[model samples]
Each structure stands twice: as C-alpha cells, then as structure tokens.
Target: MSKKGDFEAVRKDIAELMHQPEYDDGSAGPVLVRLAWHSAGTFDAETDTGGSNGAGMRYEAEGGDPANAGLQHARVFLEPVKDKHSWITYADLWTLAGVVAIKEMGGPTIAWKGGRTDYVDDSKLPPRGRLPDGAKGADHLRWIFYRMGFNDQEIVALSGAHNLGRCHSDRSGFEGAWVNNPTQFSNQYFRLLLSLQWRKKTLKSGIEQFVNFDEDSETELMMLPTDIALTQDKSFRKYVELYARDKERFFEDFSRVFAKLVELGIQRDADGNITNTDNEKGGYHA
Candidate 1:
C-alpha cells in the first residue's frame, strides 16, 4: 500500500525470482560473482573512486574492460529483475546477486547493502588495470589488490572466489576450471592445493602453467600461477592452511571480506537503507 511496503514487496518478488531454475544453474551464479568481481575490482584508493558501490560498469568504458569480457550474460540475466524492480539499480543488483549466489551455493552469508546507482554514461567507467591478472605471481597479486586497500589476509580470503568460477579461454585467455566441481562450493580448492603434487607444464608462454602430479591427467581444471603461488608462498600458505583446516573459517572470512570488497563506495542511512549519496570511498559494514 505505502511506498515502503511496495519496495518490500518488490524485494520479495526479486528474491523469489532469484530461485527460478534459469538463475539456479551454477553458471549464472559464478558469472554473477565474476560480474561483481569486475565491477568492484576497479577500486583505486589514490583516486578515491571506482568500485561496486557505484555500479558504474553499466556504462561502456567500464563495461568494456577486458577483464569483464563475457559479462553481458550476467547483465542479460538480471534484466527482468531490473525492469520489474526499477528502484534497485544495476550496481546493487549485480553485487547482491553475488551475495545470494554465494549463500545459495553452500557458501557463507555475505553481508549486503543496496545504495549503488546506475549510470548510463560511459565516462564513469574506471580505467583499466584494476582487475588482477591471472598470469601474475605473488608480487603482482600484492601490488594489484593492495592498491585497492586489501591486506594479505583479505587478498587470500577474496581469492577464495576462485572457489566459485572458472577461467574461460575466451574471457581470461586461460582455459580451465579451478575445481573439479565448479558448480559446487567447497574447500576442495584448498584441499587439492595441499594434497596434489604440482609440476610445471612443458608448454610455457609468458603466462604460468602447472599440471597436477597425479597421473598427468588431461582434465581441463587448471590453476593460475597466483593460485598455485598461494601454496608455495609461506605467508599466503598460512591462511590457506587455516582455511583448509577449518572450512568454517574460509566461509566466514570470505563472507566478510567479499562484503567489504563489493561495498567499497556506497553509503547507508541509520535504518541501513543505502542512501542516494555520491560518497564512494568507505568500507562496508562487517
């Protein structure tokens, strides 16, 4: 009846629609997470702007980021929800879907707020070099995420996102899924990391490649140099060990850190309603 009631009703409708078979497929969930990843990955602390908080990628420049290749699928997936609930912006919808995807897939609950606004103008798209390159090692990983204000623990926590999605040959120029069961959420990534003996592949491009030492099977699942570096590097390996030992810790840490990553540039009101504000340089509530 009232505007508030209408918004609540719409929210419920959107939530229910999220359960539809089309959206339930594992592909959509991982893709949605990737969308949120590309959007928020653009944060630049020095410039004091760019992140999931603004949902700026709806514009051309940001949408066109090479790291965001194949994201149109996610945008199309959310089109109906956006049309029905015009009050919710694309920025908010994309990040919220990421949270929902994580929860639905047996992952931890991601804390979410909804203040992101959509901008059609491509000028708002952040410059490139925001998303981390899968080809890089520890130094590059540190440099990239740290630029966005993430610490080593947070970096390891967020890398757990590889838990959800795979690297597409067309998308990242790397071809292989990380886990055997890409759709299912588990600490298997960590398990495999610890248990498997890895050997550098004979085929070497500037990019890194390593095959599992178990029988040299030709399955498509592959780990990036940085992903393997987690196990090799002592400091990063500690957190990975903690995650492997306690799945709960991985889920908890991931939920908190991911919430922070996506909420990087929005503000909220006293009631926790994300307000319409231009401020885009704050952290999300843990």
Candidate 2:
C-alpha cells in the first residue's frame, strides 16, 4: 500500500495529463473513463477471470479487442505518469485516472482506494466479447453488466457517464457527442433522451444510430440503441428519469458505482498480494 500522500501526487500527475494539446478534444478525460470501464467491465462473478487489476489490456489479446479500438490513446497517454510513479501498479493508475477525469471534468470526485498489482504477460486476458455491445438492447445490457456483478440501478448510474463524451466514428463506427457540452459533465444526456425527437439513419460508416432530428439544421448529438433502451424499457427508465431530473443525484450515484467499479474483482491475500477477488455478490465492493 502507498503512503498517505502518494495518491495526492498521483492525482496531480493525472491532472497534468488531462490537458494535452495533442489529444482529441484537448481532454483525455473521457477516453480514460472508457479505458477504466473496459478494463473493469470484463469481470465475471462466476469465473473471476478479469477486471482492472491485471492491466492485461497492455497485451495484444485484450488490447487488440475491437471494442478497445481507441483506448490505446488513453493507455499510452499515461506513460509519463507510470514513469514517474513506478511504485503504483498499472491497474491502480488506470482506474485512478478515471476517477481524476470525472472530477476534473467538473463531475463528481469519486472515492478511490489503491493497491492493485499488474500482471506480467498476456496469459490473464479475459475472453473477447465480454464488454458490452453498443448496438444492443436492454437484455444485452443486463447480460453484459450483470456478469460484472452490477444490478440494474447501478447499470443506469454508470450509464450516466455517457453525459461526458461522444462516440467516435473510427472507434465505435458511431458518431457525435451525447450533449452539446460533451466535455462537461451534466444531466443533459437523460434530459435529451426524454426531450428530443430522434430519427434513425444509416450513416456512411455503415452503422445504424439515432440522431436528434431538426429539419432546419444538422444534429450533432446522438444516442446509441443501448442508450435508447433505458427510455424504452419501463424498469430502466425510472432511474433514467431520476438522473435526468436531478444532476446531483446522478453525480452521487455515479460516484458510488464508479468507486465500486474501479475496485471490482480486487482482493488481497494474507501477505498483502493482489489476487482474483472473491466472486460472491457484493464481495469486492464491500
């Protein structure tokens, strides 16, 4: 474990990294969140095979996964931090970057605990297709997220993160920001979902998605089919409405779920070595 002041230094390093002139949109904050999500989202309670701790994404098997297309940008973005803070594990650095991004982007300050260790090689990569599919429905969302041990409310809370970024054409084959102020965190995503009149269109990228329709102008904000599912499904819609109505509530829930996520599938042995987490429901989160 790091001494008391170490995490504060890590946070400082991350704040510096967030504002690179060469990075997309001048903020790596959004993609860092995606990187952390993809890293932890692979956990399966039954197998205890994957999560953020391994940093297996450094290896080809996980790095090359199609769902992780642009994450290399986020990963490589942290090289300088790794160089400076050699004592911190890659897993801890990556997830803490996500926490720092949320706060610096004018979102919540997520609670985080550190001490993850990196895996040595590719042997620990989770099987492909464990991450959520963007174009799927609520059922697919449940199946994917449930494997990571999230309940529906937690899923909806985490989904509010879409409020911070856009889908890139090169990465997800989908395009446009989720809100006008994509770099700023807010409840706008849910508000837009409820307020906008979205129209389906097949883009030149050969992807199908919903775009806000305005006969007078171009629509820059979008919602994936999975995003749309929250509204269309009665059960998930409740939390969506709750978040859309109260940004503070959304922030609170988001922080809770995220703190849990960054630490998912993490357990330490008696000698204080990181190990595969106990797979029991709510085990790691506790």
Candidate 3:
C-alpha cells in the first residue's frame, strides 16, 4: 500500500511536466492519457488475463508492439517521477499520471486508486491486438470493447477520448486531431460528431479516414472510421447527441467509466490478493 501523500507528490510532478518547453507544446498531457488507457485497456474480462498492474509496457516485448506506437514518449517523460519516488510501481505512476493529465488539461477529475505492483518479465504480456483499431467501424468497436467488459454506452463515452491528441503518421499510420483543442478535453468531440459533415479521404500513406467537409469548420479536424461509427450506429448516435447537448453528463460519465476502466482486473481475487500476479501483464498502448 502507498502513503496517501505520494499522490499529492505525483500530482505536483505531473503538473510540472505538462508544460515543458522541451516537450510537445510542453504538454505530454494527452499522450499520458493514452498511456493510462492502453495500460488498462488490456484487461480481458473472461480470462482475467491482463490489466494495469504490471506496467509491463516498459519491456521491449510489450513496448515494441505496434499498438503502442508513439506512447514511448509518455513512458520516457514519466521516468523522472520514478526517479523521485522509487517506491511507487510503474503501474501506479502511469495511471496516476493520467489522472493528473486529465484534470490539468481541463477535463473532469478522474477517480484513482493505486496498489499495483510491477512484474519481473514479459512472460505474461497480454496477447497483441487487444486495443481498438481506428480504421474499423462500429462492429469492430463493439468487438474490441466488449472483450474489455464495456457496454455500448461506455464504448461511446470511451471513444470520446478521441477528442484529445492526434493520430501520428509514424504511429497509427493515421493523421490529424479529432478536435481543434487537442490538449483540452471537452464535449467538442461529441459536438463535432453531431454538426460536422465529413468526407472520406485516403491519405498518402494509403490510410482511409474522414475530415470535416465544411470550409468554415475550424481545425479541419479529422476522424477515424470508428469515430464516425458513433453517429452512424443508431444506439451510439443517441449518446453522441446526449453528450453534445450536455457537457456535464459527458464529463460525469467519462470520469466514472474511466475510473472503472483503469481498475479492471485489479479489485480482488479468491485469496484476498489483488489481481497482479507475478506472471503479471499490464500498461497502456498508444
């Protein structure tokens, strides 16, 4: 168990990292969020096979996975915190950094708990392909998220995270930000999904995606095929409208579901131990 005061130290550390002149706009904030999500996103509800406890993402076996492209920057950025607080596990540091990033970047406060322990090796890394692929549509979204124990409403809420950060060409082979203020989290993603007219375009990399078709739309933002699916699918579209019309509701749901997500496979086991076994697997991708 960690001392409560360490959380405050982490919060402060993350704040300092948010605006480093040497870094991305001095804001590693968005990528940190991605790190946390990818770390927790590996949970397999049925097999109880993977989750955020091990912070296995540090190993080449897991770090090298393409799903985690460009995320290495976040891990590298988080190292200073590790140096200062050697007692904290990388699992806890990564997740807690995300909590700080969300609040620092004008998003809702994420409820966080930290008791994860690191693993010894990569033997337990989750099998690859667990994370969502941006090129796929609603069906793929459902398949990927359902495996993680998220329902359609939760799926829609999670997808809204697209509002932050842009797809990197060297990373996901996709390009562009989902919203104008990529560093700030808001209902802008839902709003644009509701209002924008999107047109499909294939990038020079041979990737197919959508961009705002209107001349007046600021940012000329782009969307993944999966992003558009939120509106194209009736059930998902309803939530998109709800979130667009109500920012409070979006923030509330996002905070709750996101809390639920990072804690997956961590609650308890038959022996009263938390789910992080030595053959532990964990951490975020991209």
User: Candidate 1: deviation at residue 207, Å?
Assistant: 5.1
Which regions of candidate 3 are displaced past 4 Å?
Answer: 1-5, 120-124, 213-218, 269-286
**Winner by TM-score:** 3
Q: Write the per-residue lDDT of candidate 3 for residues 73-167, one digit (tens) a residue.
A: 99988988888877677888888898889889899998887667786444446888888888899999899889989999999998778878888
Which stretches of candidate 1 lie above 4 Å from their native place?
Answer: 1-26, 120-125, 202-207, 213-218, 273-276, 279-286
Model 1: lDDT equals 0.72
Q: Which ten residues in a row have the lowest lDDT in candidate 1?
A: 277-286
**Which ranges of candidate 2 are over 4 A from the true structure?**
1-5, 120-124, 213-219, 268-286
Q: Evaluate all candidate structures by whole-model CA lDDT and list the values in order.
A: 0.72, 0.83, 0.83
The TM-score, computed over Cα atoms with residue i paired to residue i, of candidate 2 is 0.90
For model 2 the local lDDT of residue 21 reads 66
RMSD of each: 4.4, 4.5, 3.9
Candidate 2 positional error at 181, Å: 0.7
**Candidate 2 residues 19-48, lDDT tens each?**
876766678999999999988988887876
lDDT of 1 by residue, 189-214 (tens): 88877877766653433445666633
Candidate 3, poorest ten consecutive residues by summed lDDT: 277-286
